[model samples]
Target: MTRTLFALNPGLDRPAIAAALRAHGRVQVRQFLHPDAAESIHEVLSRGTDWGLAWAATGKSGAHIRGPELRAMTPDARARFGLEAGQSASKGDFGFLYAQYPMVEAYVQGWNPGHPLDLLLEHLNAEPMLGFARDVSGIAEIIKADAQATLYAPGHFLTVHDDTVVEEGRRLAYVLSLARDWRPDWGGHLNFIDDDGDTIEGFIPRFNALNLFTVPMRHNVGAVPPFAPVGRFSITGWFRDK
Candidate 1:
């Protein structure tokens, strides 16, 4: 029988969460999911079979090239995607295979009616959780979501970028971490960037924690150093205004 993903945590304290969002434009909620639900998600992701490699090339012009298209890019083509002389010398400079984006929509769509991921997506887009998200983020018009599962293995990293691509309609960005025994030294921390390109604040990927920030904030996932033993897994995406 398929398991249904349901709220594990009793509820969020709306006032406190809102206060944090208002004060810092970001917030982290610990014990965000019910223990059982979180465990189920972790298990599913850990055992997941279908995942595609995703890479992003940020050109000097600041444009981006993503997904499978990155593979056949020539040196000149790579440069067009923002690879520079020194940056291109290293193999890992402009690309990485350890970084991946799991097709969540496929998982949900291909599963049986009561599949956990399907139920979880439904839970996120509906009910008390949706209402709570609106109230805390103060984005009353947020009616949809765009989310996917992500895996950051050794040497995987995401560079700085604001979640402000106008077409995405992203009002808020969120990450629900599912890594266990994650240590600061392992280096997959999510760091918020200041205007000057310095890291102003950072959050470790704690198990069952939900971290959220307003759109257009510069941020990046610190590289997972080579020695790290496990992948940093999470369900990450945006809350959109429709």
Candidate 2:
């Protein structure tokens, strides 16, 4: 039997979430998943080490390369990807690990059939959850979901950008936090920016919380400082329309 990935709180009904999204263009649902399910998914991601290093220079295609391959890029290629020429490839900023959607689904189903993450993604893209997303975002044609596991270790960060790639069909963006007992002071906040480039709000990664927002909004992941004891982990993705 496929396990239910989320057990919605009674207070977090569809209408309530829709109201919040309508008012703010974003909403966060706390305790979004059952404790056992959340724990299992968090365990798997926390112990797994097969993460690919992902990086991108401004206006360049993001590359997922191993440590050695990143070291082997030509000077021009490095510069184009926002890497400093002549500097050690591993020494620059802008780095994170991402397990892309398809690979993650395949790996989980192949190795641990009916894994929580797989089931969670399935649930999110179907039925009441999908309907809820559509209703809340007021985007009736949202028909697809894409997701990936992201890990921001010490010193890792993503720069400001509006998720406006229309070709990707993204209509809404979502993040499910699996980090436990996270601290705001340790960084790794999901921050929103205004037109003047000022930060208006930010969210700490709280375990079992799901954050969803309209796409094309400006945002960035705050850097995880070196002294932070734990890495920030989440499953993040976009809801798309055909």
Candidate 3:
């Protein structure tokens, strides 16, 4: 695979973006990455990586089943596992079904010695990317970020919740959309909710767009129905101060 930069787009208008963020408390930067980098990221996510299933049958914290081990499960065993998870979701318990590549965990634990996503993880915490995050967010206290690649495939979703990990020093949450050829009708929208649990607004999973918002805001990712043609691919994480 070609080495990717994960660099922000040189053409970005930083002042304009900063203003938008100031005004809206959230902003989406389209064509957020350099063209080649975005292309490489999308390619890697779609073809060159192993994916693991992530879900939580009860509360907010999720457990994962790695891809290879999940594949090795007997069909009935797999079905039973999924059915249990689905049943929890049906009961309105916090549940989700999606694929993820846990970037920060893999990086720190030496899970894959030279994995390509590791490069991206490091970039998120280093130099210009870190500095850019501080500048735009107007939160100079932000020191680093954690990242993970996410794929919302057909029938996958996330329930509503605010990102409130105070112990983790999370100051802002971000999602960089890499999904291409995704349709509005296909679901997979990042939606914001009000105190009443009604959706106030939503953003489509558009290619090469970045969304950033202050933490502790109510939000959820809408499910991608089975009829969708592509997975909603993205790298999501929180900028932290601690």
Q: Say which candidate scores most in TM-score.
A: 3
TM-score of each: 0.80, 0.78, 0.94
The pairs that clash in candidate 3 are none
Candidate 3 vs. true structure, TM-score? 0.94
Query: Taking the tens digit of each residue's C-alpha lDDT, what string does model 1 give over 8-58?
Result: 477777799899999999999999888877888898778843444555542
- What ranking of all candidate models by lDDT puts the best one first? 3, 1, 2
Superposition error at 235 for model 3 (Å): 0.7
Better of 1 and 3 by TM-score: 3
Candidate 3 Cα lDDT to native: 0.87
Off by over 4 Å in 3: 1-3
Candidate 2 lDDT over residue span 78-153, tens digit each: 3443342112224543333333333345444574466555666676677766776787788999997877777777
lDDT of 1 at 55: 54
Query: How many residue pairs clash per model?
Result: 4, 1, 0
**Candidate numbers, best TM-score first, in rank order:** 3, 1, 2
